[model samples]
Target: MEKQLSKKIKELVLGFQINELTEALVYERIATFVKDEKDKQTLLRIAADERCHAEVWKSYTKEAVKPKMGQVRKWTLLARIFGYTFALKKMENGEKGATKAYDEISKEIPEAKKISEDEDRHERELLQILDEERLKYVGSMVLGLSDALVEISGTLAGLTFALQNNKLIALSGLITGISATLSMGSSEYLSAKSDGEEKPFKSALYTGIAYVITVTLMILPYLLLPSSMFMVSLSIMLLTVVLIIAGFSYYVAVAKELSFKKRFIEMAGISLSVSAISFIIGILVKQFLGIDI
Candidate 1:
């Protein structure tokens, strides 16, 4: 007796089949761009699995299906810009959602269960092999980005009202930012040395450089815009802080398999709250001290 698939089952099978083929193309495209031979080979192997999985689905559907080329291109571009690790991990995460559907479908076709298991294994192996230099120095990045968001937000927010002059605000921010960068770099080096970590110099360099770049971005509006727009400059700096937090949080979430929403909310809350408090303090200090510069 030839088993029959209903319209709903046919739709589901075709959808997953297309997804598998799309993933294969994405992996193949990324592998070509990767410089590391070992990483490239691993990606190729994953792509092979994806192709095999699609073929299995094709047997059930009994129709030749093309991949979703749009998805394949989107992921290929993402991998090129953000590194293959992040791209692959994000794809694996998407597969996790599909696993539930596979489980439901397994009742009708036992092969679906096997495919789900293979997906789980792929994710496990992918994580084991996914090694990007950016992820390696995540701690340094967190320190640099976190400190800059907090320190710069508060500094700019307070100085926005305190100084009331864009030139003075910009000058003060640059001076403070430069001094803090030096202090943070030195502290990082000393701390890494104390911990017996490899390449203390590199760690310090990464931290210091990340911090300086962030500070530069935050103070940029103040430098370029007119003095009357100091308030607007502060607003821009605050917006920069949010973007920095969101960007870093998203990268870490994808790379490390963490929660982007939770991390982002916590960081934004803490940094913004500090800025709010410091803003009030700045007003109080300016009024109490009678210092108008």
Candidate 2:
């Protein structure tokens, strides 16, 4: 005799049913566009598993339900832009929480035990095998980003007060940033070559690209704005620093399953701290030397 499901358990089952079906469709759609044979097959396998899970939930609900179209489209588009690894990991993260929900429902229904296990464990292991180039070179990104934040932020802060002219500051910062980017890239290439990194050239490229992008973003305010409005430009530059730190930290957290709050605060704090110290130094330098730009 089948045990009767309570109202709460029934609702949970129905919701899971809808989500599973939606995700299955999302995976299938992404698989069609993927060029790699291994990747396509993996996506298809996951889609099949999702469909199986949906059927499991349907048995409890005893009702046919449509997938949530909005959710399906969102994941599909995200995968298309961000690549399958990020999108798949992001979707898997959602399933992590869903496993806990499934665990609770499993108390009333034994069949849900397998569903919870698959969601919590097996899916994660499967996703670990997916090759993601961006994640592989994340260390290079960190190196480039950290150096830019510390060096550029400090340079801008000190110059903002010392030069007191946006054009002068922008020119100086751009020159310094460009030189540093080249130097950093060259050093990274030589170091990686010596260390026997599989692709030294590629690593160096990532470092240079990251550094150049950061420099451009940091210098944009000074280029676009008037030289007289130094304070406003300075504030905007500072805000850009914070936003860059926050944004990169978030991307890393999602892709690598790291602590977002800890990473964000640490990077922001270090960058801002250096800027503050340099700002004071600039004021002292200007007053003591009596040099004005």
Candidate 3:
């Protein structure tokens, strides 16, 4: 017997069917490129489950719905660029909004509750098995990014107030940043080696790459702005520092299941504090030495 569902309920059920079908395709596509046999099998299983779910919803709708092919491409591309762990976890997080809909649908179709339970189970399994190799070096990345934000931002702030010349500040900053990048990379190498990390060279490389990228972003404002626009360049650089801190914190928070707010506040506070103190120090030093440039 076909049960009568309200128009709104039918629409919601169709939406769920579409989502399941899209995720099924996304997982299937992603599984093809996964190198690890275990991971690929896991993805295949999840994709099968999603397909089954879509079929369940389709039974209620009595009408076939097309999967969102655009979303399938977007997630697969994201997985390629950001790694499967980050992309899949991020996509799963977006599913939280569907919980209430699932609850609503469960009252009409009891099978919806089983699907919800399966989704919960899948999330738990993902958490346990999605540990990628790159995540192991997140500590090295944190070290590089945090140190660059604090040291380079402070250095740039001091130089901006003291030198008052954009080109000169950019040159000095590049020199300092390059030297610090090498030092940080070598230090990470030694530290990782001493700690018996499996791949110390890779750890150092991650650290160096993170540091150099941060340095480039921080220094680009001064290099691009006019020589007389020191204050504007300084403002833009500071904003970029805040953006970098927020972005990395959010990335780590999502990937590691950590607290985004706490991480962002801690890092931004430390970096900005150092910049402020250095800015004041620059004024003091310039005035005391009577240096005009």
Candidate 4:
């Protein structure tokens, strides 16, 4: 019984070490790929933090028990096979799985729960790091793209209602697309710079390019159709629906705690609110100013 308990403790220690190593590697990858110099520096800091965490776990394991050479080798092999991506994926699966295994052995063995808690702390720290830097940009880009698609698409639809000709509708859409792109891109750039964060020029440039691309693609269908009001309106609505779904899916994926119904309701509410305001503005312009295309 004592021997069995000892083996279990060794396994848990090895698992914690593997998790820390995987987190370190993730930080390395993020640092390599991130365009913003500040973001890259942040990732490097996170990687150093994770390395310290791994060292602590290793020290504890060394003090806890002496495992056979074969056993140590086997665990190392397992860690390498799982790789950083797979380990992070598992961690994101939830704290429950990691805790379950830790809980089963932590009480029976000394210092096991402490190690487990350390791993949990490391996971939370990694999450906070991601939230602070990468996730914010991801959320901004997604929301920005979604907003541009729905707003500009609705604008085109309303203009089609007034224009009643495909060529005229396409021309109006082109103008709206260009105007929205410039406006959104400028807004994003200035907002990033104003936040007191070091804004890399490349990050801002890429964001501008992406904003233009997403908006242009969203409105292009309306331009390609024949000079029919019905087809143009239909195309815009379809694109809006697709954008809403895409945005909802992204929100749900990132917001794992939220139920599907709740995420859908929240995202749908925001999309509808924006669309409604844009539509009202369009109607008022067409009626009051005689801005018919």
Predicted structure with the largest lDDT when compared to the true one: 3
- Tens digits of per-residue lDDT for model 2, 62-144: 89999889988898898878677778788878765676677779889976887677665756776777766777888998999
Worst 10 residues of 3 by lDDT: 123-132
User: In angstroms, how far off is 179's CA in candidate 1?
Assistant: 3.3
**Number of clashing residue pairs, candidate 1:** 0
| Candidate that beats the other on lDDT, 1 or 4, i.e. the better one | 1
Error of 1 at 284 (Å): 2.8
Query: Which sections of candidate 2 miss by over 4 Å?
Result: 1-8, 33-37, 95-104
lDDT of each: 0.86, 0.87, 0.91, 0.59
**Each model's TM-score?**
0.86, 0.89, 0.95, 0.54
Give one digit per residue, the lDDT tens place, for model 4 in 154-247: 6665665556676776677778777776777677777777876576443455456656676666556666666665465545655565665565
What is the lDDT ranking, best to worst?
3, 2, 1, 4
Candidate 4, superposed: residue stretches over 4 Å from native: 5-21, 33-96, 107-110, 126-150, 160-168, 183-210, 223-267, 273-293
By TM-score, how accurate is candidate 2? 0.89
Preferred candidate (lDDT higher): 1 or 3:
3
Residue 180 error, candidate 2, Å: 1.9
Ranking by TM-score: 3, 2, 1, 4
Residue pairs in clash, model 4? 166-227
